[model samples]
Every structure is written in C-alpha cells, then in structure tokens.
Target: MTLLAPQPFRPKSAQLLSGLMFCWVLLSSAACQEDGASVNCTANPEQCGIDVEAVPARLYVDPPFGLGFGCVLMGCDEAKILTLENRGGGQLAITSVRFKEGSSEDFSFALYNDEEDPADEALEHPTIEKPLKIKDSRTKALSVTYKPTDGIADEAVLIIDAHDASLPYQDSVLTTVEVPLRSRVLGSVAFVPSTDTINFGYVAPDETGQAILTLENTSENDAVLTLAALNLTDENDAFAFTFPENPHANPGDVIEVALSFTPSEYQDYEGQLTVATNDTAQPLIAVDLRGTAFSEPGIRITPSVGQGIDFGAVRFGETDVWELQLYNAGGAPLTVTPSISALGDTDPNVFHMGSTSGEALAEIAPLESTVLSVYATPAGGGAQEGVLQLETTDPNNPLITVTLAVFGNAPMAEYSIEDIDFGNVVMGWQSDVVEVTIGNTGTGDLTIFSYDFEIGSSPQIMLGSAPDLPVKISPDDDPISFAFFLNGQSLGPANATFLLQTDAIDYSTARLDLTGQVVSCIDGCPVANGTPSCEAGYCAIGSCAEGYHDTNVAFADGCECQEERNGDDIGGNCSDKRDLGNLGDDCSDHAHSVTVTGNLHDAEDTDLYYVKMEDAGSVICDTFGDSFRAKVELISAPPGLALCVNIRASGSGCGGYTDYYDPSYCGQNSYSSNGSWSSDDDKEVVAWVVWKPDATPICTNYQIKFRADD
Candidate 1:
C-alpha cells in the first residue's frame, strides 16, 4: 500500500461549512453557490474562468506558475487551458493571445473548442482571428502546452489582449492581462530503478536464487505510469519474474519486482529482464542478468594407484598399518568411503581397513584433504596380495582401487610425491623443479638397488638431481631424493614416469609420474591482429617488423588490430608528423598537389601531418568525408599564407557524431573556432589534423587533398 502525501488545507469546496454551522452568505440575493448562464453584472467586467489556474498580475506580486503544469519529464509533454469568463453587461473582445517576448518556445498557446473536454474530437488548435467576440456571461478557452527543450527552471508572461465595450479604451495595452508561467523541467523518465544489473553468482542444479529490481515513479502527481509488461527476454526460460500486483502508479509509488534464476545445466547462463511501460521518455528498460550452476568435485587419493601402495615387511601373524590421504580437487564438496576388495577364490579377510578409518566421510571441501588408515596382518606368505577400494561422489572416478601387498620381514619403499604437474612451459623454457623424497616406513632396511625411466610420445620431461644408485635407507631413516622438470623441448603435451626398484618382496617397485604441456607463443592470446608471442608463459606482440604496432595494450586480438600501415602511412603524434615539403605557392593554384591517405586505426590514434607554405600568398586545405567521426581541422596556417579550412569539424565527447541539425539529440555537439582559422604572420610551417582533437574519432581510413595558391 502506498501512502499519500499530506496536502495543505484548502476548504475551497465549502470554506464556510467548516467550524461554524453555516454562514448566511448571499450573492445578489441568491443562494450561497450558483452559476447560471447569466452571471451578476455587478462584478468585474471580466474574470478568469474556473478552469484556468491563474492570478491577476495586479493582485499577486509574483504569481504562481500559470495553469500549474509544474515539472514535466523531458521528451514528455503536459498541457493546460486558459479560460476567460465575461460577466459584464456587454460583449468582451479578445484581440490576441500569445506568450511574452523572449519567452521559451517550449511554451505555446492555441485556441480550443472546449475547455473541459480534451478528447480528440473535442480538442482543436484551429487559428482564431483577432477580436474573438464573447457575448455577455460566456467563456472563451485557450490551450497551453509546456514541452521543455532542455531541463531548467523557466518563467514567462502569457499576455491576453482584450477590449470590453463597457470600458473606454486607453493607450498602451489599455485592456491587457498577463499570467506568469513558472516551471522546472525534469531530466529523467518517470520510472527510476534501484539497480541496473542483477548477478546471481552460482547456484546448484535444481536450486533457485532471487534478486529484487525496485522501480519507482518519480514524476509529477498527475503523470500516471502504467506498466504494460514485465518478464525476462527470450531464451531465458530458467529465470522467472513476479511483478507488482497493481500495474498503475502515481508519483512516489514503488514497484519491487522479484526475479529468480534456476539453472538446470552445468554451465554459465545469461539473461535479461525487460520492463515495458507507458513512459514516453523511456518506453522500455533492460537489466542485465547472469549466473552459473552445477559444479562437480574431483577426488584424488595420495600414495595410491593399481599396485601402488605397500604395507611392507610385516612378520607372519603380526599387523602393520599405513596411512592414505584423500583430497578433493574439483569445485564442489566430496563424499567418500574406504574399504578393502577381495581377490579371486580366497578367504581374504586378512587385509582390511582400520576401524576408525572405515567410517564414511562427507562434505570434503575443494583443495582440502582427509586421512584414512589400513591394516595388513599376514598369516603365511612370501607376499600376500590384496586390493583397496575407495567409493566416492566424483562422477568421473566413482570407484578407485589400489593394489596392496604384505611381506615377511622385508624392506618397504615409497616416494614422497607421486603426481607432478608443470602447469605451462614455454616451447624452449625450462619448468620449475619438483622434488620427490623417497623414504621407507617399514621394519627392515630399504635398498634402492636399481632404477629405470619411461616416457610418453613427447619426451620433454627431464629427470635429474638424483642421489647415487644402490642407496640404502635403514628402517625409520632418511630416504634418497630426486628432481624433475618439463624441458619444453617441443610444442606438445609431455609425460614421463620414473621407476625405482627396492629389496621389499611385495609391491617393492615405486614410480613417480610427471605431466605438463609445451606451449607455443600466441597459444593463449585471444583474437586480434599482430604477430603474437609468449616468452615467460605470457602472450604479447612479438615484433614491429610488420609495420604493425600493439598500440592498444589488449592481448585478445594480438598485435595487428591496433596499428597497421603500409609505406604511405604517416606518424601518430606531432613529433612523428610527415612533412610534405612545399604545398605550392599562389592564390588560385588549384592543383591538388599533396594527397595523403591514412587510417584512424582506433579511437585514440591521431595522425598529424605538416606542410610548408612559406612563400604562399593564400591557401585552402579541406578534408573529404566531413563528419564528426573523422573530423579534420587546420590547426594553423603559415603566418604569411592565408588559409581557409572547413569550420564544420568539432572535438566533442558528448556523442559519436555531429548532428549539426540536431535531428534527435545525440549529445552536446559543441565546437570551438579552432576548426576554422586564418593567419598571415609568415611563419615557417603549420599543420592540420587528420584529427586527435577529441575522443569521437572514427576508426576508419581518412584522406585529405587540398591546394595552396601562390
């Protein structure tokens, strides 16, 4: 519910009916209120009609805004009527009706068919000749409209020329009436918003998120705003909108629109909400909307793979336990449970998960890890084999299995880091080193008797920093170490595995897998011109050898789009200006001598060129395609040579083009006198711009051809 503003007391309807029972008011011996076709002749000869909101200039020191049209939004218009009632014994002649001199054209006066009815059929602006005759006790009405051309407070006098037969005429507007009109223009639409864009970061599938778009009517009291439609645009079926129940609104009435986004897919979603209304200034408004949904979590178990884990050197009829780490590597939370798998045809309850470690895990956040333990109690074996199973919520890796083995009084060997990733490596640059610590967590001594290396299609993975072979690691003692890095020898994916052999009898071999990519220059740069290259894994323009410069610091389009030129191109700044030595020297030397053509390249690129007219008496320089986009100006002519330039060019940031005629109001198309200049000081050199004067430069080819008369 909208609350109404308090209005000042105006017992205009019946001021006498208040406080007192009643006043025996009498007007010409008639009842308190009555207005017949024939009014009393005892009153003033002429009075303002009831429909007109005006005060006589003689009565009010500073009269209120005529017709009280108040503030009206730009691009919108409001109209009122001025009525004159004749209460005299004779006819009233209205000679003319118009606004005062110097009054804004925004205000206009026209004749009307009826004062109270504005229906198309009843409203007419037909011209009326001077001295429109009004019989006694009759009323005449004139319509006035206020449609501001600019936003500002304005005041003007509305003059009504008249002559009453009952009064003798005098000099100087003998019978004249002036009504002062005052109004402050408004610049915005009736509907105002709380926010222009709505973004719902991320939501899971089947879940919904909501945002509110508040729209308020901030126009005048009578400027009623009506909502025609409210909903999301096409292709946005996932988002829904609930609008205010009542679609009509007056001043101060607010509408809080609720918009909800429920994405069903696992990718980014985009949409827009359109508010269609009856506001003449802005008929439709659009708000940007964005969100994402449905992300999965990836699970990785450290120190594990097929035959990758070992509970080594356990004595017969004895138990030993090993710890395993579970890591969530993707975007969402993960849930997992650890258990042991039975091999074929064997009562394989010998190797099992620890009691505390078998409990199901839940909600593991991304990049975070949890721990689990497994026990190996060998009965009788040279080496007992078993497999560990991990069930997880990762859609890609639901069931992860790692082969395990137990031996009697044997050495156990393991590598500290199992997986290595060198994110990105330049084609010929070496990657960062990753160290792998080898250690033994068994009862007996661990001996690395030998080692071997294997590689994928691309052998860019270099293994180094290894300790001497035949290294021995006593029980619970420090282990051997090694290092590896991506050598970036070629452009392709690099993969390799290094294996180490130990004295442990079961699962005794240990291996470390390495992976990375050898990328080429410009591999990650987005679309654009120029020879792009990557040095330290970063994209950039390689060289200016092609006569193309990356003047624009954006890597998306590489180098070419920013600045490209052939041999005919000139420099961008005044320092690099092209000097066209001598542009003829005579008045009427109409030969087009210097012809220069160049591209604007971009909005910020300004091409400056100079010419020598030292001996010329007069000159005329003009650029073709006279538009605000590629505006041309003669900065200054040679001191002794009088030059004429096109004065139509302007450097304005108000908008993109010069609407010299103001077709629809693009912006402030203001121009200074610099576009047109003349000088005869006989200076050495003067230059003109292909132009850099302002930001509205057109990004296309511009040409100039002119003659200097001698």
Candidate 2:
C-alpha cells in the first residue's frame, strides 16, 4: 500500500493468490515453454495447471415458483427480477437468450456490453453478440417489467443458460423461473354436524320437528359460500325455510341450517343440504339431515288378503273384519279414520276408531298402536269381491300397501233320483243285483250310509243280499254309482217288496207292492187256479185267458170233448155224490149203513144174515133187526125165528162200513155147514169185522138185533 507497485502492479500478496490464476498461468506458460523445447503441458494436462478453481454460479428469482405476488387483488405487473453471479474466478459466456409466449418478457439484460431488449413481435428471441462476463465479486442481473396479460395465470417459464468461457469449450448452466396463479375470496362454509347420519325417536303423525345443521369455515383463506339447495329424496312434504341465509357459510365463521319437518297425519321426514363455494380446492360441501315429524291421531288402516280365505264362498248376511294395527311412531299425537273400499267403490264412514261423525281416532301418542276394523259384509249368498286402500302423507317411505279379501256363499246340492229300482228278481234266489247313481252339487262332501229298501220274506222269496250301503263323494266328482245283486225265489214282480233299512234299524215298510197267480193247464186246456193238470201236473199263472173246462183224462182236450154222458139214475135227484143213511154223502152203490140194538153172549153158534133189497141186483140197504125167544109165566118156549146175522166191515158186500154187530146176527148158519144156504156159509161176519169171535154175547139179533135167553 505504500505505493502500489508500479512494477507491473505486482505485490507480494499476488504470489499468495497464485492459485487464483492457475488456469491463466498454465495457458501462458505452455506457449512460453514451447518455443523449441516442449514443456509438454498440454500432453500432461493434469500437471499443466497451478490448481486454479472457479466459483460456482448461483441463480436468484423474484419468487421461487414465480407465482404472481399479490396479483389476485392488486392487479399484478411483471416487476420480478432474475440474476446470475460469477462465484468463480472466471468469465461466463451467454451465447443465446430465448423468449416464448406467456414467458417473462418486456425485460432487458446486460452481460459485458451484451444487451437484450423487448421486441415488437410476440415470442421473440435474439442471440447474444458477445459472451457474458460475470466477474468475480460482481453479479449480473436481468430485469423484467410488463403489464399482466389478464389474470396472470397465463404465465410461463424463463430459462437462463450460462457458459463458462474459461474451460476448453464452453459448457452450459441452465436455470428456470415460473409464474403461478392466484384466486378470489368470497366466504367460508362447512358441515356443522359433520356426521352424515341422524336419529329421531318415535313420533306421531302430523307432528312437526326441527333438524339443526351447523356450518363452520376451517379454511385459512377467505371463501365465497352460497347455500345451493335443500333437497329431499323419497319424501312427501311441503317445507318452508325460517332462516334466510342459513345454508350460506363464511370462512372462519359458523352458520346454521334450520331444517323444519311438518309431516302429514302419520309420517317421517328426510332431506339434504348442499353448500356451494368459490374455493378451487374444495368446490361444494354437502350436509344431510334425517328426522321424524309426528302426525295427528288418525286411524291408518291396512287390510290383507289371506291365501286360505276365499271371498266368493262367504255366507249370506255375514260380515268379516280384518283388523289392521296402525302405530304412531312419531313424537306427536295422531288421528286415524277407518273406512272400507271395493275395487271401483268405497264405503264412507263405515268403521271409526273413536267417532263416526267427527274425527274417529285421536290423541294417539308416540310408540302407540291402535287397530282399524274394516268390515266386509256380504249382502246376499252371491259371489262378491273387492279391496281396501288407505291414503296418507309421509316425507320418506310414505305409501304402504295391503290386500283385501271378500266372499259369498254357493248354492246347496240336490239329487236326481231318490229311490233305487231292482228290476226283476227270481224267487228262492238270494243277493240279486241293483244299481243307482247319486249326484252332488253342494260345496261339501255327501256321505251316504246304509240307506236301502228291503224285500219282504215269503216261501217264494228269499233275501240273500244286505239292504245297507255307504259311500262318500265330493261336489266336483261324478255321482257315486252302486251295484248289488239279490238272490231269492220270486212268484212275480208284485210278490216282492224291498224293505228299506239302514244299519241295524229295521225300516222294512218301504216296500214295492206285488201279487201272484198260479193256474194249471193240460195240452192247451185251462185248469183250476190251485189245481194241476191231471196227467201233466203242470201249473202256471198269468197265462189263462177266456172260458175253459176240465177234462179228467189223458189226451182229453176240453174244447174237443163230448158234451154229455148217459147213465142209470136214481128217481128224485140222485146226486153223483153217494150218500149213506148215517154216513152222510160219501157212500156209493157198494155202500151201506147199519144200526143195531142187542144183547149178546159168547156161547152161541155162528149167525148169518141176508140183506133184503128193494131192487134185486142193486141192494141199496142191508141190515138186521133183533129176534127174541122167551115166555113170561109158562114153561120155556123155542125162539120165534132162530135169527142169526153176520156183520161186514168193508168191501162191496159190507158197503164200506165197519159194523158193531155180533156173530149171532147170522141166521140158519151152522158151525159145520158149508152150503150156500146155510148160516154157517155166510157166518163170515165174525171173520169180516170182529177180530174176537169167541167172546160171549148177552142177546142175539140179525145184525145185532136184541135176543133174550131163558
């Protein structure tokens, strides 16, 4: 410092800074040493330098990413600056500078007398005329200044590449600058009750409740918030908002969304709230609310159609009620009105929960249930049908459906034939066959048990089949058919009667009346009803016709027989039937009758008697009177006409009679006489009638005439 060395401006400290000029000394030394002897500095390049080092270059930009600084509110301008410094002990060369659309423009830069200025054309660029000199301890800077195109978001990158001229060949160093975007601020908004789910206890129908929604701004930047809409899904309600700007929220501020639910008679409420904002990061925020608003106490009835209940078959003058329970699951009271409905028609005010005139049911509280009675009455025994429907309003899940059932009765079943007919049966034959068909038109089953008619008993009729039978049949099925056989003897159809009986009870009066007739005939000749033909012995009834006579001989045809017969006749109406005196009508010419009075002893010879006839050969009568031999006061005398008689018991001689006369009734009959005139010859009375001839007789008479013995 004592006087700057004028000797080439060299100082002793300059030798201490020799490392800083290492690159310059190597280049100068190589040229000086290569005059004749080669210093070989370029060959041994690593040993040619004095260890000179270059400072690292650094870049500075106005804003790191070139985001427009505060331009969103103040309308930014291009006031940013970019600089490059020579941190090394060498010069830096800037070969070219490039500019693009939306790039940092309207700017100028100077590097060692090299300058760049704005051009008239957009996206303009100019190559540098000289290398840039970024001296040590001196920084090179480029200035950029312009009015923003519009919003300043149409920004681009600025590239600055530097070359180090101290190296063998210049190497490039690249650095970039960016311009970012900015936004506006309106208000802040957020979900107050951040949770998405809400719960409300049981509420009655037509009841009102409030759902509160709170909003807050958690964003650091101010935001523009707007309440978009309060949307309801699957809801039935007419809603009004009380708070004006509730859904609109502000940043770092709290706002409330007043949710009002006014439900119809019996319903629940559900809705959603959406908030719109200007923040790009978060555009819209959504908040949903769900609550229950109770309705008035009114009957809400629902009827069902059970599968097993058939409506078309109900009884006449009958009513059926399917009770449906309506519950108030809201917080307020409710009212219910019950009614009946058909497909095309509805019955007004038929069923009432409380009052039929006014509101039927009322004051139904929370968690309370009531029954709605729906009456479906059938007017007559005819097929009828319909349904029942109830109308109500609910915000969410409003309409519920059920089925209705109605019914009527069908007609009763009748029969076609009441009685069974057993055509024709034989006699002494049992179990004859009969058939019948029973029909049913009713809805139920018809069971027939042991209902049959019985045939009465006769010698010609024998019942061999049971009169009881049973069968079961449904209405839709064909009529039950019964077939049976009877075996019995039959005179005629009229002679048999069917005794109708059921089970063991005897109801034999149900009978078919009949009569029988049997006639005899011989070779086409009619005989008496009960008599048989003489030779053929054949009899048949229901065959005889017109007048007929009886011929009592073989081959005797009554129509071809003679009309009269000649015979010896008795004077005063002698009948063809013979009559004896005491034998009454059964005697013939070979017939006789006898009466005797006598006293007989066993000690008499055999007697014989001869009959005196009015006609010589035809003896109409033969009998003997008693004879006596006795004296009163004088000596004994012989009998008048020693009467003897013999009796005949049978045959033509005896006239078919059994006589009681004794053997003494024969006259002029001797014990040993065999002559035709002797009493002994005709003394066969004892042999003819009396088996005991040796017995004593007290008196004698011809044919039992009394004879006294003295």
Per-residue CA lDDT of model 2 for 1-710, tens digit only, reads 01111011122244534443332223112311322444443233334332223333333333344333332212234344444444334465544544445554423332322123323222223235454556533454454444432211233444554555555333454333333322323333233334553334344455655565555556544342444444445345633345545444444555566666555654545455554444445555555444454433333333433332234444444566556677654655555443344443323222222224223455555545577655556553334445444443323324343445454433233434444344433343333444545555544344455533343533443333332455545568786554444333334443444343221111212333323322123322343422333332222332222222122232223222121111221111122211222221111232232433222122322222223211111123222211111111111112432333333322334222223333353224222212221111111122111223433322223233211111
For model 1, residues 404-510, the per-residue Cα lDDT tens digits are 77775555666687889887777877888889987776655677888777534346787768878788887668777888888887888888878778776456677
Estimate the TM-score of every prediction.
Answer: 0.25, 0.24
Note the Cα lDDT for every prediction shown. 0.57, 0.37
Q: Which stretches of candidate 1 lie over 4 Å from their true place?
A: 1-417, 421-427, 437-447, 455-459, 470-481, 490-494, 503-506, 516-527, 533-540, 544-548, 552-557, 560-606, 609-710
Best-fitting candidate, scored by TM-score: 1
C-alpha root-mean-square deviation, each candidate: 43.8, 32.1
Give the candidate number with the greatest lDDT: 1
Error of 1 at 600 (Å): 9.6
Error of 2 at 189 (Å): 66
Residue 451 displacement in candidate 1 (angstroms): 2.8
